[model samples]
Target: MAPTPFESLDDYISLPRIEALALSPDGTQAVLTVAVLKKDATAYERSLWTVPSDGSGAPRRLTRSAKGEAGAAFTARGDILFVSARPDADGEADDESGQLWLLPAGGGEARAVTRLAGGASQIAAVAEAADRLVIGAELLPGADSLEADAKLRALRKEKKVSAILHDAYPVRFWDHDLGPAEPHLLAIDLDTLEDTVAAVVAESDALATAAAAADTETDGATDAPADAGTPYPVTLPRPRDLTPAAHRTVDPDQVAVSPDGATVVASLQISEQRGGRFALVSIDVDSGERTTLFDEGDVDHEAPAMSHDGTRIAYLRSPRSTPEGPADVEVWTAGIDGSSPRRLAAGWDRWPTSLTFDRDDGALIATADSDGRGPVYRIPLDGSAPLQLTSDDFTYTHVAVDRFTGDLVALRSSWIAPPHPVRIGRDGAVAPLASPAPLPAAPATIGEVEATAEDGAPVRAWLLLPEGASDAAPAPLLLWIHGGPLSSWNAWSWRWNPLLAVARGYAVLLPDPALSTGYGLEFIARGWNSWGGKPYTDLMAITDAAVARPDIDETRTAAMGGSFGGYMANWVAGHTDRFRAIVTHASLWALDQFAGTTDSSVYWQRIFTPEAMTEHSPHRFVRDIRTPLLVIHGDRDYRVPIGESLRLWSELAEHHAAADGSTVHRFLYYPDENHWVLKPQHAVVWYQTVFAFLDEQLHGGEWHRPELLG
Candidate 1:
């Protein structure tokens, strides 16, 4: 059977995505930002956007700039405040310090409130206090000298820093220049409308200095000579040690003020190696006595919220389990005295991304994605029905709820969509806020389907048929996979590019294989050890099933995915030759190398099993690859790292040898992109390159590549 062609991928690129939705104090209005990638391959330009809580008025754009804006909050007087960094400010880096800006909640010109240095990390309003905003600033971690010592320790483990002097890379690359870490938190008093360097939360001066002295003592040697002891004074002064003995280091993530704003409760992690997880403790900012409320050992806990009366504390806990499987994380409540610990009825979707308590209803409002994509859910403090407030095919990235008003707000998006703000009505209506831009209307034939894997396990999937495809002829098929081996691909999407794919004459299929999260706990673990086993087999079988339909052409098939999906794509090309073309983005090509190089080595080892490293790695099976493939990765990715993709490219070139003169191996690196192509322009460039690559390989045709921005 002949396969159908995808009309074009660009048609869906212009769809509107909603993100960063926040509610006003009155619960009548909300603020968010709409991002669109620009055409020059520059950056995404976001404007402050606002919509009515009732979905009455259209979303209003509050700012205009070639640069973008993000992280918005509503002020007490109902003014919408946000942060925007100018394009030229840092040569489109988005790293430029974001200046605080305020706009009328109704909508108007945004005026700068604070001229920041690096960037603002977080902001919160003082309860019951008007005109007061507490902001946190992120400065660099520590000086370069200290950083070098840390790097050196890391290199020594990798054999990159050898014991012998002549074997190292070179001194220039190992120079121990030092500078302060980019981000250190500071409290800003917004009411003064002025900034005061509150207190140095992390003082790395001693650590940096000690490292410098140690480096000087070593005379720039790559390794510590046999006489070298203590590994360059690795035991540097802790931030808490810098403070007067009375004051202790508050866990950075746990820095929260008591309801009356009198006490600060911070969670601190003392040692990662000692199985000492984060601890929630009270800090008398006034007296400096750091009292511990509870300590998380081997488990994870954070986002602690005090009860209305302040006698009880509610926090999320991923309780430590025996080294078997994932611990079911549930909401936990404990007394202020650290007694009477109780497990609330919260499920393990993810961490408490956001939590709030309704004063009037006495309900604990939580925004969790326990269902896979984040959505707002609510339960009573007394543990009533744990009801879901919002339901869609998308995940909620950020959410905020007002206690007094019961106003629930969320920012939601799906695999093929940009984020857009949606309000959960008290009556349970899911309504969109006034979108700053018109959303790309959904095409008539777009819908979802379910395909059975080889194991007869049902794989949930979405299908988008080409605009003009007829049942008379089988159409070309495009199979897309999602990243998180645990993440789910939902039915609702707005990225619109897939709609464009349909417009270009192809049907798009997104199947949620066994490892997808939404189907519940067991389903999520199906792809765990079965990385290339069941998950790969399921995808292939699903494709076979999809292609067997009268509407699809099996021979004209193509595949693409990012992250975990990328890993699967590489695996598919190596294991089978069914696909005409494949696109793998930000993929982990070599699991063995990933075991050693990834920051989450311990987590990976636990997830895949110790035997997985030797048995299931694609690096060990690279000699089997035969499909034409495109490998894309971000240079600045701290998570997956660029080396993973580079390793894949090098291996493909070595084995696939185009001396056969085939465009079978191609590598593309986005210098400024992260694991996900987040920026608007980069989003466009990504789709353009991907679609163009697919067009060339699948259709044997060339087309103008669309840019992310106009």
Candidate 2:
């Protein structure tokens, strides 16, 4: 029998994926970042594709390079701007840091705009009414400007120095080390490209001339090095340092420029003792002047969206979580200059994430997690209830609102579908737009299973049914939990996907228990500081409801999860011996140890007291675990460090070991991968190893190890 994509890990990894969507100024065409496996099947390369906003024509490929194109945005001139490390195909050296490139709207080849040595992270914000653009770039801590930053970087490379001196709280993020370089927002005007490059080149010429004269008189050696001169300017546009003397302050992703390009609104990461919160600020793009729009240490002001007329700003305010309870996010709108802020949709329960202004700036187009789906809502400034525009199971994101027709263009995805572009009309009608990549077909059927928790709260799950699962031949069940104790199992997941399990004739259940979002603040608060209590009970209730179906075999079951879900998996292993096997990835075994060691330690510490954390920790009842377990972790996982798994491994070997020091449990360790199996080959091996383990426990084998494991 020929295997489908879900049945074959290699085929599944080669599937094309759409990453993001960006609409043009007139909303005539939308640019999409599509990724597909490269020739060698080792890495994924991204290219830009354009789809019609009116759903009238087929999607056209816009840009392509092996270096990968991303962060697609449109300038006021309708030119498509993206970030890519792709060198000039006309014969230029490859760039390690991605440079900002622009494809002319009229019709021409793409051109590099700002040539920085460190490469631009992404296009932060593009002005709607002007030729100005703000980009997220990195500047060395000691350097005063980006030019100096480039020279310093060149000098460091020359000296072969890779060490970073840190005096801050977080020296590293999830997978990579935090800097010697500070992230900065740079504002560049497209019209002044030639003049600014000329000015910079002239300055370099004068400095070189001065150095030459001095060298002639001295030992023929001065400070201006050769590599420094290399990055100066073959042809580069200068960028205004909108943020100066920044120390990991600016939140790179949450930034926006007003339509006129005169003002920029951004989220600033304010670091505290153990962790940090974000604050919103407005800046003068040209003058580099900044004003404090909102900054409270106890609360986070994030996702700032500018009004089209460039006057008002809409943002979300989230009070810090405490041991008492988790806080609900409140959507607020205020003047661009920080005046008269008011909350929109006063009693709206959904957690709105990304926000944008409507066509006329009278209402905010916001995407919020709602009952297992992320839907776009039109929130009126009059404080009326939000109107959900798209009524579908697919989660919508990166919504682009039409300034003329008041239509919305966004990318929506679900468990059954990859991200696909859709055009939403003014009358709340959704039209599927042309996509460069077709959605992959799922091998199993998706159905809903819900139950009432012991506390009378509703718990829900997505059940994947195999083709032959019936009362005559019941299929074994796999209860898969979602991470983020604060997240919902609503969207399509490249990792932790259940289609592979269903393809193997095992029914899979994806449950969103207590502490999951979209159910409102009260629902999340139910499991607050009590990870083992409400969340665990909620999961069991939903799993019980799923197993009650005649097609599912409750006796042959396994549990799996990662991160917060991993914590629950460990808790479940200790609390019950019902499951035949359990798989926990990057799990937190000891709550006390995790609270102090995790990347965002401050936030978790505040949410759970020491005693409360210890009381609910999974490690406390390790001896009670009887189910055969497969522990998975990546050494570089700082979010839930490898130490959690290391300690758990030691305890399992100590207690569950036989007289010959052999145990039924297994440990799948990734020395190079991070919290997630991001690399294509690694992801293939991940699913392979997982399936092998499940086959051993569920079908009774001598542990059929995956081929690549050796």
Candidate 3:
């Protein structure tokens, strides 16, 4: 028999990933984004794909291109409103201007609504009454000439600084220069496509106040320059001296405007300890009244959906986990007047991935993981019994409800199936809208493995034997650690396939230590402070047990992970040189340096006490590391920060040079990506680089691309 043809990485990675499903105003139609894969560079094409709520018509593709399209919605008359960034546009930012497009809901060509450009993103269709859209828009400098003089004055003030001695440490008493600050805000007319100065949120006022203090400190006395930008009108005037902590830029995906346009509901956290909070604020869209409906404090509340009658709101809330353990999450409802807030359901592991309310009776409909299988669920507004709409064992990550018919549109995938959008039949049957793509290459053998933690706690894990391997001989192994420590590799996921390593003749081992979720609250909660302790020991024991099998080679093993998993990769290298190659992604290298540079330094402190933190940090043990390493970071990742990766790379390189021994350590940075690599093009590049690095280290061959260096 002929051997199966060798499968390329492209084949397995080419399956489409769907995101952002929005129902039309009439609820009869829907618009969603589908990412298409290309031979060389995969493109994010968000065309308007329409599927009827009744599952009668075949899904039709409306827009098609390599550019990105997002923030889809339908007008009252069923017109599609969306923002598209077309590379085909000749303008700078490449049609990144995010021009608004209108397409007839009945099927017609999408046309530009207005010429306003320069990155107008986050488009939301207001109700039928208003001829306006709430968009996160930006204009080029030339659009507002009147503010030019104010900008110049502010720039001049910032340039004027006073340098003072004794503010520097660790170096000579070099002076520290402090400069003035300035803030700006504006509003744009959706109808006329004109720019106007809106009431300044207090973020800018703090800037002006800081500027005044700086001017006074330098000159020994004086008020801010009279030439400063004029204050907005009293009805919506710029706030004066409002604390910086009180204001924030709205999340593109999280903010919502009320039905009457008199309020803005936002999910926020003032500090690390405060956890997640939601504020249902009454704001005059025109006058910006800014009255708080309620400040629901010290719990996670997000993805709020207002009822049709506007008498109450529904939201998901989760208590923040403390260092001691994990916390349970629940669904909740509250009266608009801030009274009678009550829990509708409890024991939910996570939030409703997405939620929508039925207009006619205000029934609550949401897409969530219920009973270990992610599915769509429907519950009435009065807190009635929840009906599980889709009960397939396969995981459904997202769901959208039709506004008119209450039919559901959702994404479905399982351990063996790549993701595809599905339409739910009224009778509860499910069918895929697109043809199933080719399945990813499978491991030669799939097996479930179990191990006992140090305390005799049972741990579950999965092992994938390399394809075409013989039991008589040992094969190289790769151990993969998942991030989140809180997050577990679900039993039903295509990500478990070991095709990449299998093609290269290596078995893969994925072990879940004491901290992984999905088993129970107690099991997952154990990870809060188990870092470098029992959890790490469990991983080591699991590896040791797995390698004892006749088909595994212990010496040629490598390890890789991102985020918390990245931290483990570095930790393992420092603790022992058991593996030849280690690859870390978005890792926290030096805990001490991380404590200062990371945005959530407070979270680290909360998770681990300062003493435990200093003792367990990988940076404290870098001198003990002997394994070759490769590190990857995205420049725009605020969570882990690029500096952490850089610090680790530099430290390892210096240690090798000092010891007069060559150790390979390379760092790669993706300039435009974020914490999660979303772009299909960049994701492929990352996988290729990682594989190339590991292959060279394991096989000892000259890599084709020598120019790709640290």
Task: Give each model a TM-score.
Answer: 0.76, 0.96, 0.74
Which tens-of-lDDT digit does each residue in 203-265 have in candidate 1?
234445555766676455655543232222112111111113111123344555554544555
Give the alpha-carbon lDDT of every model. 0.61, 0.86, 0.60
Predicted candidate 3 versus true structure: per-residue lDDT over 1-710, tens digit per residue: 12222245555556555555666666665566666666565554556576665546667777865565766776545677777765423233433446566666566666554333234455632443344345543322221322233444334447783332222111111121111111112222334322234423453565577567555553532343433433322222121111111322233344455555444454534333322245444334566445555555555566666665556777676666666766775677777555798776454444465666654545677766433346667666666666667777656755666555556676676533556666776556787664223334354566666777777777766677765556676788888887876665543432334556666678878777766655656666666565777667778888888888878888788988888889999889888888889989889887777765565555566667667677778888888988888888887776777888888878887777546655577777888765667666566567667778878887786664433333
Question: What are the candidates' C-alpha RMSDs?
Answer: 9.4, 2.5, 8.8
What is residue 168's positional error in candidate 1, in angstroms? 21
lDDT of 2 by residue, 1-710 (tens): 34568888888888899999999988899999999998888789999999888988998998877788999999898999999888854223755678888888999888888777687888889888999989998888877655567667767987789999988788778887789887899888888655355765775786677556545543423365433333344345678888898788976788988888999999998777756788898888777888888998799999888898898999999998899998878999999898999998878988887899999999999988889889889999988889988887889988989887889999998888878999888877888999998877787888899999999999888898988899989999999999998899889888888988888899999989999988888999999999999999998999889889999998899999999989999999999988899999999998888877887787788889788898999999989999988999999998999999999999998888999999999999999988898888888878888888888898896667778788
Worst 10 residues of 2 by lDDT: 225-234
Q: Which ten residues in a row are the worst by lDDT in model 1?
A: 168-177
Off by over 4 Å in 2: 1-3, 89-94, 195-231
Pull out the clashing pairs in model 3: 415-493
Q: How close is candidate 2 to the true structure, as a TM-score?
A: 0.96
Ranking by lDDT: 2, 1, 3
Candidate 3 vs. true structure, TM-score = 0.74
Question: Rank order by TM-score, top first?
Answer: 2, 1, 3
RMSD of 2: 2.5
Give the higher-TM-score candidate: 1 or 3: 1
